[model samples]
Target: MDTTRSLVYIAFCAAVIAVLAQVMIPLPLVPITGQTLAIGLVVTLLGKKYGTQAVCLYIMLGAIGLPVFTAFSGGLGVLVGPTGGYIIGFIPTAMIIGLYFEKFGYTYVHAVIANIIGMFVTLLFGALWLKLFANLTWSAAFISGVLPFMIAGIVKACIAATVGLTLKRRLQQAKLLQIIQ
Candidate 1:
């Protein structure tokens, strides 16, 4: 893959992730989403620079009122909604995961660790956002916003790590990893 091809691939992956965001598995609190898996996979496969660009583009498209978020809802309202913090956190999440890939290269364990860290970042931002917007106390906001998602998030992170490592191996075998960077 050339630079242009790599960029196009990244964009396509980002679009796919955005579209996946709309296909939500409804949960009591935050839904079980495939978006974070996509984010982790993209960063692991594409490395820091292109991976970050992919997530940024995804967020930008959603923010601009494209129905690219979970439940096919978008716009500034989504940004200020209870789920907004999670959305906002995607940027840093991708960056952190990408940093791991950049520094240590792609590995299953590293991918999992990076995603675990990313989940914490998401929770931090999400809890704060919930507290501010909903006027709930820390415990209430955490219970409402973060606690329910804990187990699911860990499962998703594991899945993301597995998928990322698989993609990394495939890309490496195909000798496309160099082009991705």
Candidate 2:
């Protein structure tokens, strides 16, 4: 892609992440958010490099105090606070899922698998950060950080994969796939 189109894709995906972060559930420790689904969608659509850049841009916006984080909150404080790891976790999540599509192929099955694995990595980082920042024990961290999100993660991954593949196929058919990976 050209420089303009690449930048546009990054900016657009970053905006999508911001928009998705608004759908928060306001839980006690970590709010249930649409971020994972958004990451899955962006990675499946943009591939590794562009997708990672988009996520990084999203983080940079949040780091600079943009209200792009969950619960419409942002800033360095939010990024380093109790739930910040999940926010930071998007980087690797995008990389993992996007890498799968680029390395293997952009199939529905691959998307689903990649998304699931990415979700797990996010959970791992989230739980670890929760343990450290919240001063919770490992079990407690697992309970609060991972347990509640398990089912939702699977559902979100499936939704992202299904939608991603459908949209990808449509784009390919329309010859607009050249703009993407």
Candidate 3:
């Protein structure tokens, strides 16, 4: 597509992430948020280039104190906070998911697999950051930061994969979004 349209898609996806970040199940350490689901959708729909751009834009917005992160939190402090790793991790997660689709086919199975992997990638980043920043042991981090969200993350991945692929297909058919990997 044209540059203008691509940028619009990226900006729109970033907004989607910001909006979805508010849907959360509060936890002591890191709340379960729809940010991941939005990430999955953005990458699945936009592929590597635009998908990664969208994630970066979202992170930059939050880092600049835009209240775009979970719980309406933002600013550099939030990025360096215990939960910041997950926010930062969204970048690689989007790239990896997009790469997965680029290499493999954009089928439902592939989308689900890529999204699950992306979830794990984000969890790994969050757990590691939680351990170091919070001064918690590995076991403590796993229990508090990682384990609680596994099931929920899986469910979100599946939902994102399903919805993302469906929307991508429909958009392409309608000539709304350009054909993506």
Estimated TM-score per prediction? 0.90, 0.95, 0.98
**Tens-place lDDT digits, model 3, residues 92-178:** 999999899999979999999999999999999998989889899999989998899899999999999999999999999998976
* lDDT per residue as tens, model 2, 91-156: 988998887888888877888899999899899989999999989999999999999999999999
Winner on lDDT between 2 and 3 is 3
Which has the greatest lDDT?
3
Minimal lDDT window, size 10, model 3: 172-181
Clash pairs, candidate 1, are: none
On TM-score, the stronger of 1 and 3 is: 3
Ranking by TM-score: 3, 2, 1
Estimate the lDDT of model 3.
Answer: 0.92
Q: Rate the local accuracy (lDDT) of all candidates.
A: 0.80, 0.88, 0.92
RMSD of 2: 1.2
lDDT of 1 at 166: 83
**In model 2, how large is the Cα lDDT of residue 144?**
95
